[model samples]
Target: MHAIRIEEHGGPEVMRWTELPDPVPGPGEALVRLGAAGVNYLDVGARAQGTGGWAAPAVLGAEGMGHVTALGPGVHGLAVGDRVAWFYHPGSYAELLAVPADSLVKVPDGVPDELAGGVLMQGLTANHLGTETYPVGPGDTAVVHAAAGGVGLLLTQLVKARGGNVIGLVSRPEKTDAARAAGADHVLVHSGAGFEEAVRELTGGRGADVVYDGGGADTFTSSQLALRPHGVHAYYGPFMGVPTLRPTDLPNSILLTYPVVHHHVATREALVRRSGEVFDLLLDGRLTLRVTGRYRLAEAARAHADLESRRTTGKLMLLP
Candidate 1:
């Protein structure tokens, strides 16, 4: 078997594709033959600085889909040759993985391999933002930062599906079409702050019901200012920069929360249910997944570099 192993955290150049002894399923685990693995900024963080609790001297990646080749002792509800996907499991950069069966969900029919392989991590994050952090309803307004990016694109569709309006934010003009294509009601091309006024104007001065912030400190204030009084501000990813705030620093009586996807799907039943909702939306044609890049598993270093450059949009998948 071959996997991307990083001896020390540094940069994309540190990732190396190397052969290793094949993994075997352990107790309560399933041995999966790798079909596709999702490439995420999380992997880059793990490689570059050992962020996200993934220490060095380890294989990279946490999300993917594959076929079950074998099951370990005491495992049930799964069989050999079943197609499965997991939202969180370390060492997913390899060609085969012995993942806990409880962490696995059966991929439903009509879900493409690419979507099934990569959707859960970012998809569940979007799901948590739209459902738990703030349940978007009809006539509600949401300001989503990085609306053309992976989580933003999906969150746009989710807000639309829930009958809410989306004001999408993009860093570049070239990204406007992508954000609009994902069902954003309006797209704004800007940097840092200064877009709150536009958001207020779009909402007729009442301001947005919520702001889904994926970027870090630079846009933090603007995201908060764009929301109405008592509106929710859900911040998820902070790979860019972490912001600081005092309780008195908060404006508009707005609520600020840093939502983690694990809390949204804390149990196996919740995982099955939440993932089913995402898959059903995809099957019903209401939610569309954009896979903008695909790479060979051995070429993972190049994928990391591309993601780090922040040029690629939507999802990137690695096929073994």
Candidate 2:
């Protein structure tokens, strides 16, 4: 099997496309022939600084869509030739993956493999963020930082579909258009001076009922200010480096919460249930998975480069 492996952590250059031994499914696991794999910023972070959970020479990818080719002992409810997608910690950036049977979710008949691969991780994150973490409601106002990025765009659309107004913050004008296309009611460039003021002005003096802070260090403080009195601030990612916050940094009238999807949806059953709900929304056309870039599995290095350079938008997929 061919997989992208990082023998040592450093930069995109460290990601090597090399031949690796095929993974053998263990009991309660299934061997999946991967169709597409999603490349996330977490992959970048893992490759740059060895993922704390794993040793070096590790295969790096968190989620993907594939077909089950073989089932290990005790595996049931899935069979050979079953079309499925899964979320796992590592080993997805390969032609074949050995994933736990419990991790596999049957892909609906109409959802293409590409879309399935692109949306699994980001879509689920967006679902938990909008519906569980902050619970956006009709007439609610929210701010999404890096709103043109992968999970950000999907989250903006999901929030708006539920009738919430979204104020998006991006680093470029092109991203502003991208966010608007994804249902953002207002878009602000985060680069120039007065970006926070722009957010304040857009909300007409009063700020948003919630602020989704994905761009960590660069936009955390501004995101805090963008929230309305007693508003919920959900800080989900650290694409810009994790920001530090003190008790005094938060508004007296607001509440701050940092929710990780894995922690929120703790058990396998919970993950499957919440993922199914989001999948239904996707099938109904209420949610859109915008795949902004696609790369061959062998071009994993280039993909990481593009993501780090901020040359792409929305989801980035690796076709196997």
Candidate 3:
């Protein structure tokens, strides 16, 4: 088997793709022959400085989709040859992965391997943010930062599906059409002058009902300012840098939360339920899974570099 291992915490060069012994299933785990793996900001953060309780000299990645090749002892829900997708477990950037059986979700026949891998973590993230975190509804206004991003595009669509008006924020002008196509009511340049004021003006000085800020350092303050009184602010990702929030940072006593997806879907039942809804939306054409980039397993470093550059839109995948 082949895998990309992080030799040390640093830049993209730190990842070394090399051969390795094939992994075997352990108790309550299953061996998966990976078809595709999801490339995420979390992976880049792990490559720079390890997280999710991992150290150097480790295979890096958390989500992937493939076929079950072997079953471990005490695992009964799944069998060999089943198509599956999973997230949160590490070491997914390889030809084979030994992941817990409970973490595996059966992929529908209509969903391809690449789309399955690309959507699990990111889809569930947007699911929780749009449905559970703020529960967007008719007549509500939403401001989503990184609007052309992987989760951003999906969240924009979900928000619109629920009849909420979307004010999408992107770093570049080229991304406006994509955001608008995703059902965003309005698309605005995030780095441009007076973006928060623009949001206020769009809402007639009332501000947005909900603000989803994934680009932390660049958009955090503006995200807060764009929210209406008693509105909710959901901060999930901090690509630029983490922001500091004080009580005075928000006007009108707006709500602030840093909701983690893992915590939202902590139970296996919750995971299945939320993931099933996301897949249903895709299968029914209510949600479109945009896999904007692809790379070979050997090009893991290049994939990470592209993701961190923030030039790419939608999900990026690695074919193993």
Candidate 4:
């Protein structure tokens, strides 16, 4: 099997592709012959700083879509030849991955491997954010930073589908257009002065009912400022960098929530039930899986470079 391994963390240049022994599934696990692997901001963060939780020489990737090539002992619900998509903490960026049986979800008919790969992590993040964290309603308004990025695009659509209005903040004009196409009611370019004030004006002075701030350090303060009193502010990622804040930094009246999807959807039942709803939306054509870029497995370094430099939009996938 071929895999990209990080012996040390620093930059995309550190990623090395090499032939490796195939991974064998353990009890309650399955070996997936990966078709496509999703590239996420977390992978970039891991490559740059190392996953603070893991050691060196780690395989980095969170989600992928593939087929069950082998099922280990005690893995019953899934079988060899079944099309599946899975989320793994550290080993999806390979030709073969040993994923816990519990993490595997059967891919629906007609959903391509690329699309499935694109959505698993980002789609599940959007589902938990929209349905669990803030639970946006018809008249509610949300301000989503990086609205043209993978999770942002999906989150915007899910919020709109629930009848909420979305105020999308993007770093570029083209991304602004993409955000609007994804169902944001208004798109605001973040470079302009008074960007936070613009969000207040868009919400008719009360501010957004919820603010999804994945931009981390750069937009953290503005995100809190853009939320209404008592409104929730959810911070998930640190695409800019991990946020450092003082106790007084947040608005006194607002509720701050840092909900990690990994913890929120910990159980197999929870993960599947939540992901099933997302898949239903995708299948019904209500949700669009926007795959903005694709690269071969050996080009994993280039993929990371594009994501880190913000040179790509929506979801990026690595085909194996």
* Strongest candidate by lDDT: 1
Per-candidate Cα lDDT values, in order, are: 0.92, 0.84, 0.88, 0.85
| Model 1 per-residue lDDT tens digits across residues 104-125 | 9999988988899999988999
- Tens-digit per-residue lDDT, 146-239, candidate 3: 8898889899988888889999999888989889889899999866325889999999999999998887676777777888889998988665
At residue 74, give the lDDT of candidate 4.
94
Give each model a TM-score: 0.99, 0.96, 0.97, 0.96
Worst 10 residues of 1 by lDDT: 235-244
**What is the clash count of model 2?**
0
Q: Judging by TM-score against the true structure, name the best candidate.
A: 1
For model 1, what is the error of residue 11's alpha carbon versus the real structure, in angstroms, after optimal superposition?
1.1
**Model 2 lDDT tens row, 82-146:** 98987554878999988988888899888989988878788888888898888889999888878
| Candidate 2: C-alpha lDDT | 0.84
Which stretches of model 1 miss by more than 4 angstroms? Answer: none
Tell me the lDDT of candidate 4. Answer: 0.85
Can you list the residue pairs that collide in candidate 2?
none
Q: State the displacement of the C-alpha of residue 194, model 3, in Å, after optimal TM-score superposition.
A: 3.7
* Candidate 3 local distance difference test against the native: 0.88
